[model samples]
Target: MLEMLDNPQLVKIHFETHDDLVLVWANGAPPLVAEFVQVKGAEADKLWSVADLCLRKKQAVGSSIFEKSLDRDQHEETACFRIVTLRPVVSALTPLTYKRGNEARAIDCDEMVALKADLDGRMPNVVSKRGNGTGYWLDNCQWDARHDEVAVKTHNRMRLFEIMQAAGSLLLLEHIDILLDELRKLVKTAGDAKWKPDKAKKILTRKAFLTMWDACLAKLKDDAAQPSGGKLIEKMSNASLTGTVVAMAVDMRLDYARSVRTSRYMQPDEASQLQGRVKSEVQNLSAKRAAGTLDLDGPAFHALCVDRMDAINASLPADQGDRSAFLKGCMYDIADRCLLRFDRTGL
Candidate 1:
């Protein structure tokens, strides 16, 4: 979660006993307000449409404002009330294809409308009156509320990461790993002494360690951009992100190769075999073209590829049950790769 909201200037208080996620922004910027957020879906199996959850007395955003331990006298009041949900709200007015990315699914429009209606009635702050001898009116009750959907939680971490970057947080890679290891011991030794709000505030407010963090970030950035940094970049680039992209490329094999540039998943041994197969077939096509046995024209080459792929699929084992779809799809992927290679290298 720290990595998700990776802003150095933004410190979150995790009290180990509160439902409220408090965000304190101490960038010394004027008018910057603190945010109090409620994240739902911690106990739910699935998310549904409608605002039933929003008005819940214990867990909803509206109630959180009152339930939170923010002492108004201590200047801990927040200006933003937010709820983050894991699932999409599906409603009647929702488009059939609500989400564009394959990773993120769409929500129902009817569900969204219900939630919006429920929140609209409660939001923008409403004050009630009691006809007692003393007269008191509510002021400074305005707040901004938002309901957010974070698509596949694991898959779309980059969105949160980009937010961290935009907030001037550096992605320190290995250097951070080392610093964090040292920090773990530092924190452990410091014990609860530094855990107090005032003591902790001293850490960020004084900017005592800011120079050290800055130096490390600058050094890491400089090292990563130098000629020697090619190895670091390669190591970092070939992480699980490369495998994820490779899996996607394999899924979209029948399509163009635009998504295959980062292809890095298949085992080296298996890749060698596929490489051999591709080269052998390319060589055979080149020989046929040279001997005038095969036409090299665009349409002829395309037709020839289709015929060759069909022949290849015909050799699939007879036991391959329901042979129509998988066999055909496999053939298309190989054929598409071949065509893509030829287009790229003309070999």
Candidate 2:
């Protein structure tokens, strides 16, 4: 749940059990969000229903808020609440029924509507025997904590893309959109169902989108490093580095990234995950160039790659690990991967 809220825009955040989670609006602009919220399961089963549990808590909290309001000296802050459940509310045709005190009634209408009514005090207060206060309720809500990790992650991935866009990383956002659009189409096409919302989430969630963005930033740092900041670095244009140089630079980096990914230290599954992360950058690089956004000339590209290498070399000790030095060596090797070195004679 917190992971979903780890957005750049969220100015304040907190978490708790029973309370579950708490968030306050930041900048008062973004309309909050649908945080994915993975639900856990058990043979013993869940402790509460979306409507029942929250309906009760809302009354209790509302009563408290009401009591506090009477004091006038005390102030109460409004909070939103959400209840996520593994099971979907069955259809009214199924005649879902529940006990409200000694009476049981058919859930003859939309369950959520019924729930909202209970929460808002529009219906008979079934929260507790006390039924005091106007009844507590949320400003907004959802029942997202689901058993499906893919669905959960997929929901979060889209939110993460929103975060990226808000952060002004347009190139990364467009790339993720392209990939997700294709993946969603492929999933629905393969399922052969008319179309369900859940199918799309699974296919796109498995790949780490943020990790792809991190790789892009690393390349940007590489781009910024071009000419190693000798005044040239301050104004180096990606246009300074041509397309051919970038393709070659990506090739060398991928090989290094792959070797690290598949190293014996990594478990088979872990290695695959690492490879997946690097490969995403390769794809994004291709997309960006195809879009004509990045096309630095030879000198600029060389400087970018070299600066990234220099940063690594400066940070670590010269002999910390043979493996570390070797990685740095790979960076240097690509310093001229696409450019031919010529003597002053110009041969």
Candidate 3:
């Protein structure tokens, strides 16, 4: 799944298909290419052998591991097959262990000949189709083995962290836990049986995944950008504010943070200008209080808040002139950060 996320060419991912997972990629054209993967959680002591992969359930045809993987093969779209397991394969299958290079894996001529003979003996008709079925399978199939679940998870987290860093994420190390959890939930939801017959729900497109990823990053940024309410509540309490008013103020501060973070209903430049204007107003208000012209009373604080809201609203264009609540929220957010004060004492 992490690999799919890292791949730029990947367009869609399908879970719990004929294969364990399927990855689709496109190159600005008609037919789409796909890679079908079969995941095996084998015991540590087990080793995959040619005979084991060819073994059929109750002697039934097309029930073997190799046959099942080949069943997903379609001539309509160019596709490759893969078997990923936690156990190693026999020495005869060493060619499958080779890493992906120009192709999925490098197949030795002698090894392919012997494997083809073995598969041909087991399923002559199936192995002889499309000129040479075993040859095609040998060319496209990859065997990725000895993957420890815990190690893969750790690597996935590291990979995700690297991706976030490359994308200039401001999220901290602790936030990776949240992001990973969300990704896990997304995969689980995509694989849910209830969504069967609706491929849209079962498959995630790259565009949709990117949008979701951006939302997750934005939420982390918003959470980090917002000031904690504890100090704000204490300062408001010192100002003799009612509990209800203090709670409302804290909520407004959160609203302001989200609006600024998302640039909600505003262009990026407009949002920045509004924030700069609010900060300038805050500094001016602080200066007035320091000059002893502004009284250190709850009524005075309320009046100043309303006055600033009105002033900011008047400055905005006609379309945005009704954002009094948003302007007040911006002031409350400044107060939350100790940049604005309502009382004489700097509590």
For each candidate, what is the lDDT?
0.38, 0.38, 0.72
RMSD (CA, Å), each prediction: 17.0, 18.9, 12.6
Q: In angstroms, how far off is 277's CA in candidate 1?
A: 21
lDDT by residue (272-317, candidate 2, tens digit) is 3333433343345334544658564447444544554445445545
Residue 14 displacement (Å), model 2: 1.2
Per-residue accuracy of model 3 over 1-347 as CA lDDT, tens digit each: 56656777888888886467888878568688788989887454868888888889999988998888777775566778888888889887767777544342445567667877787787676752334487678777889884687887777667876665465442323456678888889888877854446677778788889888879877777664556737777777777886788878788777765554443255434555676787788787778887878766864675676598778888888976576666778778667767777777853
Compute the lDDT of residue 39 as modeled in candidate 2. 30
Please tell me which model should have the higher TM-score, number 1 or number 2: 2
Steric clashes per prediction? 9, 13, 0
CA shift at 237, candidate 1, in angstroms?
A: 32
lDDT (tens digit, per residue) of candidate 1 on 1-347 = 33313456665443221333445566566645455445555534444433443344754543533323122212333343334455443442132123322222222335444543454454434222212110111111112222343334322344433443455443322233444554445334433343455455323221434454557546645443332423322322332224453343344332212111212332223333433444455557656765678756543454454455455446546553222232333333444334332221243
Best by TM-score: 3
10 residues in a row with least lDDT, candidate 2: 338-347
Candidate 2 wrongly placed segments (more than 4 Å): 1-9, 26-75, 91-141, 145-147, 170-347
